[model samples]
Target: MDVVAWQFLLLVNPNDEDAALQQFAAFRAALEEAGGDADPAALLRDVIDWKAGFHVGEDDAAGLMDALDELASRWRQRIDWGLDDDADAVPDTDAVLQTAFVQLRERHYSLWTAETGEATLSGWITHERDEEAMQLVAGALGLSARPGIG
Candidate 1:
């Protein structure tokens, strides 16, 4: 079997928990609405059951954790820039650019492939404060903090 690996990160603002949850609800509703003949719940369950197979070495696990931390730090920096600046004025350009990159990364996940192997890691990162707003906050934060992108 050919090997493949994928990684995804999602992020949300610490202050937008309600909006995130609402978006998630809307997504679910849209899915249900589109399921003309099939059961929405069953469809969701089946999708969740489809897991990509792969393996992570100890070093890879450690690296993943480090990447997550970096992402979170970058998100926090951007948020701080927004909070410390005038509301009517634009925030720091560097922060804004970083945040934008974070958004893009969260929207796209990476894929890796190798012979006889495949792996997919999909998730998000955000501030602890944004947990209630979005489930993928963590993923978003991490992606933003990544070097060269966020």
Candidate 2:
């Protein structure tokens, strides 16, 4: 894989090289679909699945929760969002995310959010120790990343 592809692969699918290659292909296709002008970060936002990270829509609170839970499950962790999962009323997105961030930090995992210029919550979680490493990867991708809290 090329350097960019390789870096993206590592970010989205470090444990499975084959899966990373496939996700990279999807990202390339997404980029082309955007008339070659989509923010790279946006295209990459929802690319990774539960196996790695998550890219979810802004209004999709359930989706966000599911993605977060799935990602956290990798480390045998979970978060209590302090609400019913089946409730029709969605809690504040930022609040819920901030809650998740705090909960994850206790477990030594960092949840990240990126500036994708879209109506979406896009990010992934990595070990706290990987915060610097995540910055380097985001820099390579030419995107800005930050911890996902309120």
Candidate 3:
């Protein structure tokens, strides 16, 4: 039997409401240009509802996931991985993990809001399996194939 993967919830920071709408428009245009039969207005509605913690239907969910995955893939490709000698060096794994945590926290604050304003994109992923999901995310992010981490 094939293992199922839990869908990953990707939270993107669009910077503001205008940017989010623009991004959604671009996605809609691309889908239309590709002859996709999905309704752009409905898709946008689902995305808006998604931000409010509502469950989108399977087809719409899949479409949103695909759009996010494509965006992430493009962004990942643009990353420049290089180590600078002048950069600060961490002394140990614990320090590195701490630093990572701090960064993640900072990012969360920067990308999320508590008021009625749009500055970020957030969604959830659900699946019966965890390992498969991790693998998929690793592959999507262009990381080496290492098990047990997402």
**Which candidate leads in TM-score?**
2
Instruction: Report the lDDT of model 1 for residue 32.
Output: 69
Q: What is candidate 1's local distance difference test score?
A: 0.32
For candidate 1, the TM-score is: 0.24
* Candidates 1 and 3 compared by TM-score, better number: 3
- Residue lDDT tens for model 2, 1-150: 246645855754546678777778887887778874676665666567555767777878878888888877766789898887577786767877888999999988888887667677778877787788778878877777777752
Put down candidate 3 lDDT per residue, 3-69, tens digits, no spaces: 1111122223222445455545555565567465654323433443434222222234334333333
How many clashes does each candidate structure show, in the order listed?
21, 0, 1
- By descending lDDT, how would the candidates be arranged? 2, 1, 3
What is the lDDT for 48 in model 3?
39
Please give, for residues 69-132, the per-residue lDDT of candidate 1 as tens digits: 3444444432223343345544343344355345434544222211112242322343343334
- lDDT for model 2, on a 0 to 1 scale? 0.74
Local distance difference test, each candidate: 0.32, 0.74, 0.32
TM-score for each of the candidates: 0.24, 0.76, 0.27
**Candidate 1 segments exceeding 4 Å error:** 1-13, 34-74, 78-119, 126-150
Q: lDDT at 74 for candidate 2?
A: 67
Residue 96 in model 3: lDDT: 26
Leading candidate by lDDT: 2
